[model samples]
Target: MEVVNRYLETQASMCFSILYDRYAGKIFGKCLVLLKDEALAQDATQEIFTKIFLNLSGFGEKAKFSTWVYSITYNFCIDFLRRRKKMQSLFDDDTEVERLKDVADDVADEELMEMETAHLRAVLDRLPADDRTVLLMKYQDDMSIKDIASMLDKTESAIKMKLKRAKEKAYRFKQEMFTEAVL
Candidate 1:
């Protein structure tokens, strides 16, 4: 924090570079999971870093720097998806179900389990950006509900509800996949 303050005060590129070195990988990982494309994630990571640098002066001390950075990352990715109109709902086509079924029938039990995990990932990707973000923040990043609420600027209860719904949605998708496999 002191270093960040100094960087803000001095406008030193080195300080900014240091910050980037410390956080770029984590930011890229978040972008990759949210964007679900390596190229898009890389581009998004660059854009996110730019936004963070430009907005450094506006950062309040209410949240940790990492939290603030992650908030920015999430907002950028969600807005990007919105602008592109690319948020597809899960199980939107019979072709996808057929594809999964075809793969499920040919695989051994171990491979089938792996495929199931992959299918769940695809389902997660298909969820609404906000829902995916909430799930990742809670489970992947292991964020506390309070911190998530603060980061999202929502009430704790609202965050809780969102998390619950996201989990339920994931479960439903998994069940649907399994049912499809069985049939």
Candidate 2:
């Protein structure tokens, strides 16, 4: 808050640099995971920082600064993928209602988090963009369901279901990859 206030009050370049130095790597890493291309991620990191600098005055303190930055990063990557793919929905919302009707058994978060890092990375790489993004927002970023729902512009219940589905997909992928490796 102090750093943000100082930056906003003085509009000093050094204050802004402090903010950039703190978040640039994290934002780039997230962009890489979602964009899945080095060149695109690099481009996105620069663009996202530009957006952040322009929108700094609008930061309302409703969420943590880190959360706010991450939401911006997530939105940018999602929009880029949507535009590039020309997809109707990144979250795959068309069948959401139908899928919600059937209450699939939940996958435990501990199970997913406890997997070996290499195996976990393999599983995440195989997931759809929507699934992988949701999982990273939840576990990797330690974001709450409410924060995620707000960021994604979905209801809390919808985010819960999405998280559940992503967890299941990740778990299944982990099993398949390791099983095939063993055979």
Candidate 3:
């Protein structure tokens, strides 16, 4: 924040460079995960930072600086995917209401977190983009439900439901992969 405040106060390029050095790699990794293509991730990372630079003056203190940056990153990736796929909606919505009714079992966060790294990655890869995205936002990014809700422009309960379904799907994918491997 000192960096942001300094940049805001002096409009100095050096302060911005410090910010870029700190966040660029993390942002790029996130882009690569969401975009699923090295070239497109590279392009998206650059474009996202450009948007950040241009919008620096508009940074409000409502959210943490990291949260604000990630919001921009995630939103940019989602919008890119939407345009590329020509889809009106990027997330699974109420159409799955019937599927969501069953709650006989829930996947514990520790179960997902404790998986071998490669297995975890494989399971995540098998999930639909929307499911993987919500899981990343919740577990990997440590984003709060309120924060995610705001980011996705959904109600808090809606984000919770989405997150629950994502975890369930991830767990199912993990089970199927390992079961098939053993067979």
Error of 1 at 7 (Å): 1.7
Off by over 4 Å in 2: 96-105
Candidate 3 lDDT by residue in tens digits, 1-183 = 889999989989899889999999989988877877799889998999999988988999888999999999999988888888834566647464434344467879998999998898888767667777788888888999998988998899988888888888777777779967798
Q: What TM-score number comes out for model 1?
A: 0.70
Write one digit per residue (lDDT tens) for candidate 2, span 63-172.
89999899999999898889888445787675653233233577778999999988887888788889889999999899999989989989999999788878877877
Q: Pick out the ten consecutive residues of candidate 3 with the lowest summed lDDT.
A: 94-103
Model 1 misplaced stretches (Cα beyond 4 Å): 87-120, 175-183
Alpha-carbon RMSD to native, per candidate: 7.8, 3.0, 2.3
Model 3, global lDDT = 0.83
- Indicate the worst ten consecutive residues by lDDT in candidate 2: 94-103
Ordered list by TM-score, greatest first: 3, 2, 1
Candidate closer to the true structure by TM-score (higher is better), 1 or 2: 2
Cα lDDT computed for each candidate against the true fold: 0.75, 0.85, 0.83
